[model samples]
Structure formats: structure tokens, C-alpha cells
Target: MRRPRPKRGERRIDAATDHLAQYGFAKPQIRNVIHDLLQLYGRDGWVFLEEGSYPMVLNRLLEEQAQQDQDEDGSTITDE
Candidate 1:
């Protein structure tokens, strides 16, 4: 059987949760971060995902995290 669609607000929350999961964020922290991002960025934050910008956000976050890791390691990474 097909699944039912989530209500509007619930859909955003669910998307936030899913986005967090995709980036390896734990549930408890995911809830908080999603809430904060939504609050700070407002509806545009959720809308961006619907418009297919979710992957862009995820990629940016991943790149930032990788840079942080490199900084911590004190070694520079060379791109091929």
C-alpha cells in the first residue's frame, strides 16, 4: 500500500529529520539542529528542500566538515 502524505508542518520536520540522518546526525541532536535552522532561516529553509536544494545544503555541510577535519589534523589535502 502507498504511504499517506504528512501534514505541512510535519512534512518539514520529517524532511529535517531525514536530512540530518543523511548527514550522519543522531536523532536527538538532529531534532534540535533542525529546529534551530528552521527558526533561523524561516520557511525558505524548508522550501529550499522542496525545490531540490537539499543536496546542495548537504554537500556544503560535508565540505565544511571535511575542511574542519583537515584543520584538526594539521595536514593539507591536495585535490586531484
Candidate 2:
């Protein structure tokens, strides 16, 4: 079944944060990063999944986290 649409503003932000929680990155920081990302695209508008920008950004964030882990000698990764 199709999922219900997210409400604009707070609900959408919360949903985005919740989605990000599935990752090892810091949730609050990632939320801020997501906000900045959305703002960046707001002027140009977003693209569909067939476009590479969305996945590229996500992969870049994961790569950044990996870099941070290496910088910390691999001790900062989240367990859950």
C-alpha cells in the first residue's frame, strides 16, 4: 500500500530525522545537514530518483561519516 503523505514543516522534518536515525550519523547534526540540503535545493527545486544528485548527497554524507570515524581512530561509530 502507498504510504500517507508527510505534512509540511514540522512533521516532514521529524519524518526526515526519523529516517536518518537508521544511519550511524548523529541525528541532530544530520537533521541540520538535511535542512541545509533542502534549503540549497529550494532555490533550484528538487529532482526525481532517476537523477543522481539525491543519492550522491546521501552517499557523500556516509563517506564523510566514515572519514570522521577514521579521524577518531574508529571509536565514534554509533552502535544502533
Candidate 3:
């Protein structure tokens, strides 16, 4: 009887799979969200950034929102 053989250049990533299986949680609903996030990871504006300060990002976003609100409010007053 002939035995099944692995494909060429097919490297085994046992550690990676093990790590994901070990630490990664995938509850019923969580699985879907994880899949969606993975799909968005490589898309435009959804870059895979490993290092960034969450607080800094939050502050920047808040500042941008404040600036946008100010611009809109100021523009309306000048036209009034």
C-alpha cells in the first residue's frame, strides 16, 4: 500500500498553531469577529500595526473631533 506524502515546501508551523490554540479565544460569536478583523488586517486603512500608544491615539482622535466641531461651528457663525 502507498502512503500519503506531504507537498513540497510545506513547512510545518506547529508552534504558531499551538500558540494560537493555546492563548487565542474563539467563542461562538467571537469567531466571526476574529475572522472579520483578520480579513480587514491587510486592507487599505486597516494596517496591521503591532506597536502604537493607545492613549496617544485616543488623544489624537479626540483632538481631531474637537477641531472638526470647532470648524463647523465657526463657519456657521461667520455666515450668520
TM-score of each: 0.47, 0.50, 0.29
Ordered list by lDDT, greatest first:
1, 2, 3
How far out, in Å, is residue 7 in model 1? 9.0
lDDT of 1 by residue, 3-22 (tens): 99978657666676676677
Better of 1 and 3 by TM-score: 1
Per-residue error for 18 in candidate 2, Å, reads 0.6
TM-score quality measure for candidate 2: 0.50
In the predicted model 2, the residue pairs found to clash are none
Q: Candidate 3, after superposition: displacement of residue 43 in Å?
A: 19
> lDDT score, residue 10, model 1?
71
Which residue pairs collide in model 1, if any?
none
In model 1, where is the ten-residue run with the lowest total lDDT? 49-58
- Candidate that would win on lDDT: 1
**Residues 50-75 of candidate 2: C-alpha lDDT, one tens digit per residue:** 15534544665787777877888955
Residues 1-80 of candidate 3 have per-residue lDDT tens digits of: 99666564341222222323343322332334334544665443223321242232233344555677988888533554
Local distance difference test, candidate 2: 0.60
